[model samples]
Target: MVIPWLSVLWAAPIIGAGVVMLMPRRALAKWVALAVSLLALGVTVVIAAGFDPGGEQYQFVESRRWIPSFGTGYILGVDGIALALIVLTAVLVPLLIVAGWNDADNAAQRRSVHTYLALTLAVEGMVFMSLIALDILLFYVFFEAMLIPMYFLIGGFGADRVASSKAAVKFLLYNLFGGLIMLAAVIGLYVTTAGSDAFGSGTFDFRAIVAAVAAGDFAVNPAVLNLMFAGFMFAFAVKAPLWPLHRWLPDAAVEATPASAVLMMAVMDKVGTFGMLRYCLQLFPDAATLFRPLIITLAVVGIIYGAVVAIGQTDVMRLIAYTSISHFGFIILGIFVMTTQGQSGSTLYMVNHGISTAALFLIAGFLVSRRGSRLIAAYGGVQKVAPVLAGTFLVAGLATLSLPGLAPFISEFLVLIGTFTRYPVLAVLAATALVLSAIYVLWLYQRIMTGPVREGNERLRDLVPRELAVVTPLIVLLLVLGIYPKPALDVIDPAVGHTLTTIDQPDPAPTLADGNAP
Candidate 1:
């Protein structure tokens, strides 16, 4: 009998969250949470090991009727695109639990440690469900639901309670507004399908809709389709926090605890870009192609805007938040470019950015915890007192700037190359962020980690064993994926080819001196 791998992968965390909440001791809760996350990771690894890159587009699929009357169902599956993110989510949650081990204990308005850990696992489960849900309605339900736990994680536990609360509200308001629009879009899609003879009673199954669309059976008015597409795209763009819609990210990321912030940015946020790839492009190919130019333009603007803003930030955590905006810009750019390399790089970027940002932000959080400040001028020579911490911080910082031989470097290279092929001028414009990123990262490092040891910084302790355990794996993954990204690329490439094929996009052929396509 075939095992329900997708069900097992998603259910483990949610069940573990319940078990964690029942634990009597804080230490027990922490260990149990870590063990549960590790279990999820193990399950993910087994699934990955069993996954055939060149096999069916979505492997380990499970489907069952949920509401036959409304045409919705319980459906789960994993393509390579989704699988890569599943690995990222699974790997990061365990470390995040480890990193935030004491975050709740020290919060000004303290909550139970079990509550915090349970919420983290809850978020993990919801993210897992969102990534694998093959039914559009199922995906949307969890997509909106994950925000509740995240809202509390931000508002209830942070260094500054008031700021964290405000940030949480802003985060909620922005995403909820986007989700509300997406709800209308979801209904619109269902209504459209219900009317079409192709689907009979209508269905929310993603594969079914894509097949109908591919067969030209999804005969809907262009104007209505564009409107529905806008509804969905608006929500995703807001979630992806692209440019103008990105105002909530910096505030939320800065105010939340480092681990919660990483969960939000590194893992949760990828759902937005992932939706753009799976739903927007496949469900409404014409609409996606129609708005491609506008999306690409916004992406380039975000790349430059985020980097430029980051350079001027006085707070360390806020600076890192802005850098994510810049990095996300690249991911969105790659997705909209409609090239194999671009999409693959975008997919890989989601994972690499998670590792790199987790390392940088968590390390910065540790330093802030030590010094009790997030200011740039708070320290002058951290390396003198805590050489190991300083060294790790430097490596993470370099990775953030996409230094060569680091994980992010290859991802960024492919994005630029992919974009340049289709949109040269915009690619050139986006490349300027490389210099901008270098300035901010190097300058931030120079100010915090180097020079003479500051008066207070001299007493700062290096990373403890727990912190080392958290930081070491992330750093090693950055190095390993950096030096050899082939393993990941192998899984990602075939999925990308499928997406490009579905969208009717082919990689551009190079031309010779005679102007003939090669």
Candidate 2:
């Protein structure tokens, strides 16, 4: 059973932030942050170890009446799915702090970074809680609370303050609009439930409402359902940074530093996809089915468009921004297929993307530290001056291209294979996106590392010991997850399979697209 560590886990990062603020020296802040993350990670591990795979109906659940006036409660729980992300958050935050050690920002900036790091951990905790928040309103609160730290990170630590803050404003406005719309949908869900005695008394419990809707006890117009689905999906897609609505991502990534970028690109971005899995499918299955084709179209478009644009990027950061768009396109493709393999692949992709992206961003950070610029043409033959650094980048970049032995390769393969059953033609098109990834990944590598050295590049040094401490674990994780993904998958496969079954759509039987069999 899932036991509630909601209080403990939530308290860890906030306390760590307080300690960091109190600590006088930068060295002490680093140690404090590391210690806090490790502690929280241990707690997450303990929660993971205690999780019972067979009994996944929200274990470690702690629910109490809190604000009965609005029909909400202090609710918390975790399933295998939420646990995986919680572990990912705990593992990544400390690594991000260590990765940022080489940043040349001023003392005030460092303070802001440390405080932001703490806030990120705090946000991660809320995201963790919200993942399993069974009550609708409680879930909404934790969900909206994540924006605070992210806004500061992008606005405060971004490369060009003016531009970064502008991007943050755009992101805030877009998401805020989406969130406000979703609130209306949430109110609708509550109002529909009000006819039942349990809900008529004003309860926001999701399970009861789902039961009421399913039994046709809740009289919701089909049109109303469709509108609600649109509201929720729009918010999630914007967050997923799906095409059309994804304009915020590239701009934000371009301006933010590696550490801050990791928060936005790696952790926070998953919220969109997570919302799809949890809300769209979980709460509005009919509407999700209705919207499938349109969403899939956008996903495939993003896949190809992102790849094409990335190939033309002149700046490394901008190129990475586009590459992520290309990659998440596959993720959404897998999710829409509505099969066990597809959903599981999408989940695995979320985790693997976090690992691969952290590596790529960190590598970008190293290059920036040396060249003082992110333009691809700003330096060449960096390997001559910093062989270790270039080699690390090569490894990371190959992984980005989904090199066969790396982490992304396995997850990307699973997603593509999963999609072949439900979307033969789209899956075929998705394969081309991988090819484009290879072209740009390698192209980026060659442009920056293998050509003739440019002037002023001779002074760049290989990764120092401190930097290695930050990067080594991420690289090792990529390899480890690639070769032996059983631990992660054991959690993912069953969870995703269970989740898909919960939705209106069940697994679509397979038909091999490569012409092996019908």
Candidate 3:
């Protein structure tokens, strides 16, 4: 029965993709994606309802043979962490589709509706499966599979198809090259464990490797593990678009439709962070320890740099893209801090970011739809015309800036608390970025949503019923989760605790910029 349920979770979105592709009307395509997202989300909730948080091993797990000779099988399971992301994916997919309901205003744009819809569904399915994969090879497969749909999303459904395609290719190349390196590393890992296979064959089973490491059946030298870790981290770094590698993100986000931007920046982008959680910690604990300082440094730099750049951006979408970089910085810092609080915060940050970032991107889409521009200066005093739209924008803007009652505030606060215990100076520096975030987010809000009414701005209309329907749930979730994050944090804490325990490392104590470890 669980197998049946897992199969539905995997297949439902794909089926929706097919349905959308088959439908003649763009309207039907939109609804098809929405229905599929809701259906998959429904299945996910049911899985959570049945999931016992106390279960040590993965529940609702299903494993069946796909390649008998190769010792490869289709194995899937959900612990609390994967399930949380699955739920986030389910929530955002529909929001993206609904947010972009009017994105394609012309014939050329209309033609892309089905393809974009289908690709989004496919990406959702792939990402969900990737998070649950027990086998390393399977995880890698699904991980790379996500790039396909996202490539189409950014490339095909973008604001300028040519620019989008170029960015897509850039995105694809950066990811694929990283994947190839990881494949070599995966193969190396498989070969190293080839002799221990009970099936008289090598495998890419993640759990098996963890067991092997624990049992001392094989020992990985720190150096070799470091190499593989580099390959894996390279892939995830590009995906996370960490600081220096983040150039591609702003370009792609600016070029993308709000739906594409939301899923890309919020959903698909989380894949990078997820990979760090699952792969870096699971596969390369020693390397993680070895590289923690460097990665943490990158994370802090991204936090400050991203915030500073966001302040300078005059384009709405570009500013949001930069905010993601800053948010990711905090998330990465928390994860690498390797403290219970840090890991928990990082996990919570992922879920909260999904809600908040997706909402911001969706709001930006509506603004563009009305104003026909992505420039921040394009309109003024829009509150005079569209109070509802302006109000929603305020919520989203405040949420992005991590205002105290919003979902991100709690998560970001936890990250700071956790990171400070291990990296005080860095945490303080990263904390400074928050003040800057307030500056950009509030100033951007004031400039775009308030102040003097422009000469032609009086015609702007408030959020309509359908648009309100899409935004209302996200806003409510934002407030509810903000005030009471225990429900999400409960599931998150255990997984993060387990992850840190598996690695068996305490966070390093905070110290000065010099080598002194106080």
Best by TM-score: 1
Q: What is the TM-score of each predicted model, taking all chains together?
A: 0.99, 0.94, 0.95
Model 2, stretches more than 4 Å misplaced?
1-3, 102-104, 107-114, 196-200, 211-219, 510-518
For candidate 3, lDDT tens digit of each residue in 105-194? Answer: 542354477887788899888888887888888888888888988887777766677888888888888888888988888887787767
Q: Which residue pairs clash in candidate 3? A: none
TM-score (C-alpha, index-matched) for candidate 2: 0.94
Model 1 TM-score, all chains together: 0.99
Per residue, candidate 1 scores C-alpha lDDT tens digits across 1-518 of 98899999999999999999999999999999999999999999999999999999999989888999989999999999999999999999999999999999998667889999999999999999999999999999999999999999999998898999999999999999999999999999999999998987878988999988888888999999999989999999999989989999999999999999999999999999999999999999899999999999999999999999999999999999999999999999999999998999999999999999999999999999999999998889998899999999999999999999899999999999999888989999999999999999999999998899888887999999999999999999999999999999999999999989987899988777797887
Candidate 3 residues lying further than 4 Å off, grouped into runs, are 1-3, 105-109, 195-200, 507-518
Inter-residue clash pairs, candidate 2: 2-59, 2-60, 3-60, 4-60
- lDDT values of the candidates? 0.95, 0.79, 0.84
Instruction: Give the higher-lDDT candidate: 1 or 2.
Output: 1
Error of 2 at 51 (Å): 1.4
lDDT of 2 by residue, 343-451 (tens): 8888888888888988998888777866789899897999988998888888888889989888888888888888877787988988998789989999898888987
Model 1, which residues run further than 4 Å from truth?
A: 513-515
The pairs that clash in candidate 1 are none
lDDT of 3: 0.84
Each model's Cα RMSD: 0.9, 2.6, 2.7
